[model samples]
Target: MTESTPALPQRPWRQRYHVAAIGWTLLLAVLLVLSSLMTGANFGTFLSNIDQFLALLVQMSHPAWSYLHVILQPLYETIQMAVLGTTIGAVLAVPFALLAASNLVGNRLLRGLIRFFLDLVRTLPDLLLAAIFVAIFGIGSTAGVITLAIFSFGMVSKLFYEVIETIDMGPLEALKSVGATKVTIIWYAVLPQILNQFVSYFLYTLEINVRASTVLGYLGAGGIGVYLQRSLGEFNYSATAVIILATLVVVLVIDGISNHLRRVLL
Candidate 1:
């Protein structure tokens, strides 16, 4: 026993716990627990209420196929509104993106101002904008179009400028050495590199607007969502299921088209 006790176990200093990481992890866990409590997110409550959710899901699973014909036109209108709004926004974003790009616009003050304006535009929620526009434009597709256009503008401009900033500087410098005008240099150097990416972003925004237009329709902005509201108000879960399924199909098609366009363009 004395001989065995002579060699004590060596401390593994190299394998010691990281105090800072442990402290941070514990702090994060405490915050999550506090947040869950404040939000009334107890597992017991969820378990008690789960039956109602399951019943609703079961009702929604059996869709009213006959309702499809009635919703087709409104679905078409939603797609039309998305296309118009996204086109308008994509076109308008070009100039703003050019002005905002650090590489393109060397003026720090100007870039800051443009970025600030864009931030302001993006700060407002699209639903709030739709409500405001609905009031002004009298609750029609006009309000929806304007709302989608402004929303698309904010998103596309930010994306476009980020793409522009990543482009090769060589062409830009080459054009400058030949004394090319700003427009000429952008046309020859910048546009060629970023145009395909711009098209890709445009299609992406269009896809999103297609879904958003349906939500905007809730405010009487004119789309399938108007019918969706009515179906829910009447508690016709079958019809509601039909609407949801149709919307999902539309979104899937948009995704396919966007991918095809990206491949062809790029």
Candidate 2:
């Protein structure tokens, strides 16, 4: 009793609400509300029109099973476009990747320029590429192929260079000490370590291109998406459902294969 401690003062209710998380949450909610208003998003109108949306959903649920045959050829074409495009882009990416790698390229100027060019390429949207190519190539798999090739190139080059830069400098140093040429060093010291990773990345990019190829066709680039656009224009929701389901199946299969290969390689 001779050394009794004083009671601690409690924070006020207003102070309790002064946490960083609460402040951030309130700010985010306010921003969302303002954005919605500015964008003409009327939730009340959406709620009122829910019945029509439900009806459309009900129509899509019952897919046209017999329409699967109609899509098979175009679906195969889509796969072909994806495969061709990914392969072309991957091949083109190798030299660019070698040039861009910091460990491989001694010239900072060259590396920086390559990186800047890559950044510019990567910034171009896939849709815009598709549209431009369609205008040039006149609506066929040619447009689709070129668009995918460019898209894949921009993506895969960056991935490859990053992989190259992370490789053990030990092999490179040893080769350089022995007076090995650049090509020999790259072939003997560089390729072996990064090959698996490169393949893994190629497979991943291929998976993305497969999906992108379909979308490109919607803009007259020639794939299953052409049929998809047609179906939507005709208001044939059942056919659209079938097309979507088929695309999902193909994507799932590719994903499964890609995952299995990655596991084995990695």
Candidate 3:
């Protein structure tokens, strides 16, 4: 019998990466040049404005402590709007997410339709939505709350469906084999796997809603943003500084709570 020769080792796929790297570098260079030209942006303009920006910074350094007490009511209203909106949105997202999830919803057409609708909703800017609601509701926190709720719904629905898609199929299959109802399977099998992610996203959305609500007040939807607009209009830099600090505190607190919850859940 003839002796068989051993097979030679395969070469690594290295040349393709070098080609890709060169292509990406060229693309980035072209994009940067095009963007700079389009926007008329230059390093010189930025340098010239730097001193004036620092002057404004110096003016805002001394915060107006007396304005703090006056802001408390509006600040509380902002928090309330965020909380109510997030809760309402999270609750509403549950059904939409289930419908949009490909694994959960067997019908491709239905899933596609649901996703399309979700995309439509998400496309509407939060500020525009708030303005519309403000027009309809005639101002106050109601417009802000509804606008935030809708925004959260669109955002959380997308997040929830993505979480559902990423979950392990094993438990889902087992639950199905045991003849559990769809709702029961979701509660016992699906929710456990993705509950933490859901909560995390919810908290993240809450943080965003808080920031958005502040802006919504600019449209007279009602929130701390109304005062923010007034302060800026009046050039009350000290009061603006106070508002900025207070907003920073709220954001940090929410971030801390989100991190703690994620750690415990995970």
**TM of each candidate vs. truth:** 0.87, 0.89, 0.81
Error of 1 at 257 (Å): 1.3
- In order, what lDDT does every prediction score? 0.92, 0.94, 0.90
Name the 10 consecutive residues with the lowest summed lDDT in model 2. Answer: 12-21
Ranking by lDDT: 2, 1, 3
Question: How much does candidate 3 score in TM-score?
Answer: 0.81
Steric overlap count per candidate: 0, 0, 0
Cα deviation of 46, candidate 1, in Å: 3.0
lDDT of 1 at 31: 99
lDDT tens per residue, model 2, 54-129: 9889999999999999999999999999999999999999999999999888899999999999999999988899
Candidate 1 per-residue C-alpha lDDT over 1-266 given as tens digits, one digit per residue, 9 for 90 to 100: 34555767775654366666788899999999999989988899888999988888888999999999999999999999999999998899999999999998989999999999999999988788998999999978888889999999999999999999999999999999999999999999999999899999999899889989888888888888889989988988889999999999999999899989988988
Better of 1 and 2 by lDDT: 2
For model 3, residues 56-101, the per-residue Cα lDDT tens digits are 7887998998999888899889989999999999999989998999
Stretches of model 3 off by over 4 angstroms after superposition: 1-30, 42-51, 168-181, 184-189
Q: Give the winner by TM-score.
A: 2
Best by lDDT: 2
